[model samples]
Target: MSSVRLLIGTRKGAFILTSDGTRKHWDVSGPQFAGWELYHLKGSPADPNRLYASQTSSWFGQVIQRSDDGGKTWNPPGTKPEDLMGPDGMPKGESNMFLYDTSAETGKPLTTHQHYDGTQRPWEFKRVWHLEPSMTDPDTVYAGVEDAALFRSTDGGKTWRELAGLRSAKGHLWQPGAGGMCLHTVMLDPGNSQRIFVAISAAGVFRTDDGGRTWRPVNRGLKSQYELPDPDADVGHCVHRIAMHPSRPNVLFMQKHWDVMRSDDGGESWHEVSGNLPTDFGFPIAVHAHQPETVYVVPIKSDSEHFPPDGKLRVYRSKTGGHEWEALTKGLPQRDCYVNVLRDAMAVDSLDPCGLYFGTTGGQVYASADGGDSWAPIVRDLPAVLSVEVQTLP
Candidate 1:
């Protein structure tokens, strides 16, 4: 029988939830790195026992850590967050260099970039927003950080180097969204290792055919009417989150600031498929494990109101990919529920019937073992869940 593991990152710390194939009773472990912000946690697809984490602090800065024994223990190749600085104020170690820049400055941006209205703003490394382990390399992982930059760590989070070439994709014009300019989504093409896609707030989506060496903006069809002088501009859309089916790498689904979009040509272009959704403004999106045509999204009221529409918590499912959607509300709260789901908070596991899971800001982690036909909470209280990822074990 297969087993399952749920790696949950929360605002206060991290937790590991385990269950067998049946996924009925679960075993919960830890508030690891307690009192710290566990922005993201992900396991290597090539070696499930190997895991990586991004831990951030308001006073200590950011540090990357790794675990070799399936969450039993963790100690990445980097220095401790509290130890990033030395007693004499000199640079201490490798993790201090921060993302692509690699400068000695540990916390803030040194240079400035063009903002949305063509204003200059310093890039901020607030935290690592997402961690994507290479599907085939256990030691190779990708980290997407705030203020929008991509970094790769091939030595199991021991060291990181920024993919400086990403700047060629008109990065100067990229601006921060309400949550800061974060390269929050990094989707690897299952069929093409050399091709990579990344999404940035206020900068739209960019794709690279030659790994991370070169990138080009693929936002030709993305339209952002708000916060831009030209809604038709090619590089200022605030893409909330993007999802790609493992079998169909070229096909993409997006939960934009206000519209649900689909890209049939590998993000070369896009078209809105909001269809019958109550409100298109929301975060987080996922593709079903076996059905590429099926997708999921949680509909929030609007960008201004970051809660479910009509005070109801509902997960919308689309069997036809985009234009068509139905609310999955069997075990969900339908009244006065206003919890918001973040971009990295929803995921699907590749089980026989497949399974769907998501975490909400109200400290609730819900699961659906038989797809989205029904729902149940694995845990009702945790520190405002930040991100959720699932792994299926043999």
Candidate 2:
């Protein structure tokens, strides 16, 4: 009787939302590519009908769709949008490849390093901010981009390859974090598939154990003082989200840009649990598929008022992992409600009384099949929620 396929990503399109495991009667179909910009959509815990999408656009760029019947129908794996026409055949639109690797092996040329005021900048091609499939290879996948790099595709979303050793290991001391150097968070260690973990928003968490070639800066004891002046530097520090609980894969959970961190050892080091959290200033940090110390966040109302604090809307639940917190607020929306929760939006679903999804920026998408105490709104208004994944069909 398994069912529940949420996979939403908005700002314009891509939704799926089904239900049957009684996720409370949902069945919404989608905005499906109806204007593009679906920052992420994932499925394929081995192959739940395989699905992947990153569609994007500035006017039309970065496609990467794919969906083998799970997401209804989608294409673009080996090209087919009129075959990317041209020569007057019409559609010669978005496919300029997405390059980066202007030398690597540290042989320079990512504009020769620099930056921090030294300036040098080059590698551009934005879009795709998180889409990781392959917890066992449904054609494998992983793509997190935007000035920050990391790409791979083992034949499921057409082709892509750029594990350029995480921009040649240092990528010249990464920067940009008002949300530009986006690698948006990617965690895969279902008990060690080579070990991987990423999150970069100013450049903070990074770890690779021989898989993505090599990567380091685990940002020890992360502290951002106001976005680093040396707030214990190891990497600039912005990290808006990171969560792990594949049966305790070294324990890690963060939602920085303010605080609410933990890292038993996998991330090397990190500490502020943001205890009693009311305003640890937030984004998204979740865990608790089966409660590996249970975790989740969504405090907001800081970093210049992103919303939710006295305007209500809470969802704090930390069952002894962090410094203690608990603010579920049954059915949510505590008051005027201002909305803002992004950092891959928020997700969790291993069913059987462990489901808790999230999405906002005022477009709503909350859910909680008995996890965060309570909540609903399987989809409300749509169009601003940027990412949220879930796939448990059968």
The lDDT leader among the candidates is: 1
What TM-score quantifies how close candidate 2 is to the native fold? 0.36
Candidate 1 C-alpha lDDT tens digits along 274-328? 9999999999999999999999999999888999988889999999999999999
What residue pairs are clashing in model 2?
Answer: none
Best by TM-score: 1
Judge candidate 1 against the unseen true structure and give its global Cα lDDT, from 0 to 1: 0.87
Supply every candidate's count of residue pairs whose N, Cα or C atoms clash at under 3 angstroms: 1, 0
- CA shift at 294, candidate 2, in angstroms? 12
Q: Per-residue alpha-carbon lDDT of model 2 for 1-394, expressed as tens digits?
A: 9888888888789888888887998988888888877988888788787788888888867788888888888877757754566678776433335566555453244543435576867667688888898788788888888888888877676667778777655667776766677788888988878989988887788889988887888889988887667898888788888998888889898888898889899989888989788789888888888879989899897988899889999889989999989899999988999989887888888887988899897888999999989998987898888889887777
Local distance difference test, each candidate: 0.87, 0.82
Against the hidden reference, what TM-scores do the models get?
0.93, 0.36
lDDT (0-100) at residue 26 of candidate 1? 92
RMSD of each: 3.7, 16.9
lDDT of 2 at 346: 84
